[model samples]
Target: MTESKAPGAQSSYEARKPQTRGRTRENTPLRHNFWVDLKELIAIPDVASRLKPPPKTNKRLGLRKTAWCVFHQVVGHNIRNCLALGFQLDELVRGNFLKDYLQEPQGALTTAAPTEDQGHEVPIHGEINTIAGGFSGGCTVSQRKKYAKGVMIVETQGLDLTLEPDLVFTKTNLRDVVSHDNDPVVISMVTTGRKVHHILMDQGSSTDVMFWLTFNKLQLSLDQVRPYVGCLYDFAGYQVEVRGNIQLCTTFTSDAASRTANIKYLVINAPSAYNILLDRPALNRIRAVASSRHMKMKLPSLEGIVIPMKSNQKDSKRCYENSLKTKRGVCSVTIQPPGED
Candidate 1:
């Protein structure tokens, strides 16, 4: 066999950032997520023992079913589609074998700002155009008429929707988040290479919104704000004035996997507790599913991996408390010094 079939020593594996997203162009054979994560999680001696065996329902009855299950070692259901497996996985994710995969946004990788051509957007540099609260002032007649005409549909051109990963919600996801039944899902997101706190996942919103104070805090260039044509409504259906809109990439992360999506946010010149509000459109664009009850968000990452992230319970309480202050005309924001970020 000479040197063909024999290896004196193997080179150590180096984990590198993806050179190109899909169909990697680099000559390197291994991928960033090349390791079989499930297998690794299961390989742990403690984890392998902690996992309960598959139920009797997973056992194949005859030769008709071809969906093979790893847990049952049968053909009743596909391994990925197995509910028992997903449940156990989510359970283990909380504080067991899968804990290694759970991580905060601070540990995740963040990409730079988009280089795509931003349309000719007339940026407004002024601080506050309306009241601090979003619903305080209504929109103008012209804005109302424009909004009445048509709905603005954000185009999805650069989004990578190649893989469809399984998203599941069970008792495991609701473990610690549903105690008070008053927790609002608040999670930090990496936007423009910065960890932005108090990001609210508001599914009721038709479009994403960014507060003017938050926009300024991020130190984002005013040139990125595009003119938003339509008007936005408040809780009473009264049109609320919007400052402008900007498209920024926000990363949704879970344990060791993360996914980035370009989100078009309508910047509102209102002071509020929340820095940004992720709307239904943004969720759909990211292919994300949020469970307010569980206070968790899960998205499909590249290579069909399910990325799961949890909300900050303390931050959620803080945001809501601040929101209550805003409702009572007593809102306050901590001012950062010149040297601080």
Candidate 2:
């Protein structure tokens, strides 16, 4: 391969270099390594047909040599060093086409790394307090560990709002003038589409009661009464007789806001200060709170707004005075209508 040249001058490439005959495979930059030379692999009829030939070029770069690529069927390079051929073979290997022929060890990472797409879920960096209290009320371990730990073992998205935000009471809710604590929450409510006054909302009582006198005054049919199998308990002063209970549409209104529910009233034959006695059950049903000091009953309406019903102060004092008179046998129990308690 030695050729004579002028002093300090480079010789012609063809004269200085050994003749390759275009047969030598260029070192493949592609990373695909196979158990055998790709030239030998594509010998199979199926592989040969699938193999894509590199672009045909009639013009040779004046290299007077001959070496044929089986894949390209051209005189340039071997299939092993062909960039296009190597890439296609790597794709076939990844598709499990030449599994046994691959240089990558069995069960090794041969495929390209997976890319994140629309299906991949991103980590949501947020938490919600579905359970307010934890193991301890004071949150002994601080807020999270404090209260109701026995219940909050597993975190979860819980109940679909069976309750609204808790309503609170304030000093402004108190009566403008100091009223005696003896004042009762006696407000008017609509029942059977008629305004019924002297309805006492009492928390101490265990049942919602409508005296037989008011029951008759409403002109309700006896057929509407369903047989109540429960035991009857009498209030102080009279032996109460239990009439079958009836469900009535009773509405508590505070100006524009109102709440109405079919209340199952235990129609009782007894004399009391009020026409309708709403006890704990009724108060709870309407989600109401009665304060004698405030002289008003506040309840959440259907829309979750607080509605305030001011107690009839004049009627409340009258009932209190009459209650004293009744204890002294001054007021008769026969006319136990409104303002008699």
Q: Clash totals for all models, in order?
A: 1, 9
True-structure RMSD, every candidate: 24.5, 30.3
Error of 1 at 272 (Å): 1.6
Error of 2 at 238 (Å): 5.4
**Model 1 regions more than 4 Å off:** 1-162, 236-241, 328-341
User: Which tens-of-lDDT digit does each residue in 1-341 have in candidate 2?
Assistant: 33333333422222112133232333222345677776777776555555555455553311213545565565444444444565566555544566677777645543333222111112223446322211113212332333346466775878444544355667887746356767887899998978999987766554577889899999899999876543343333343466868889889998758889878787767666678878766787787888777788888887877888888888887776666654332111111111211
Residue 186 miss distance in model 2 (angstroms): 0.8
1-341 in candidate 1: lDDT tens per residue?
22221222321222233344232234112111113455465566655665666445533522325545566566544444444444455444432334345553323423222221111011223345322222112134444345445457566678554678679999977777747556788888898989898988877645577888888889999899877544544544444556788889888776768888888887877657899887677888778888878888888886788888889888898888888776432122111112211
Estimated TM-score per prediction?
Answer: 0.49, 0.47
**Model 2 ranges with Cα > 4 A deviation:** 1-165, 175-178, 235-238, 325-341
Worst 10 residues of 1 by lDDT: 115-124
Clashes of 1: 1
Error of 2 at 30 (Å): 92
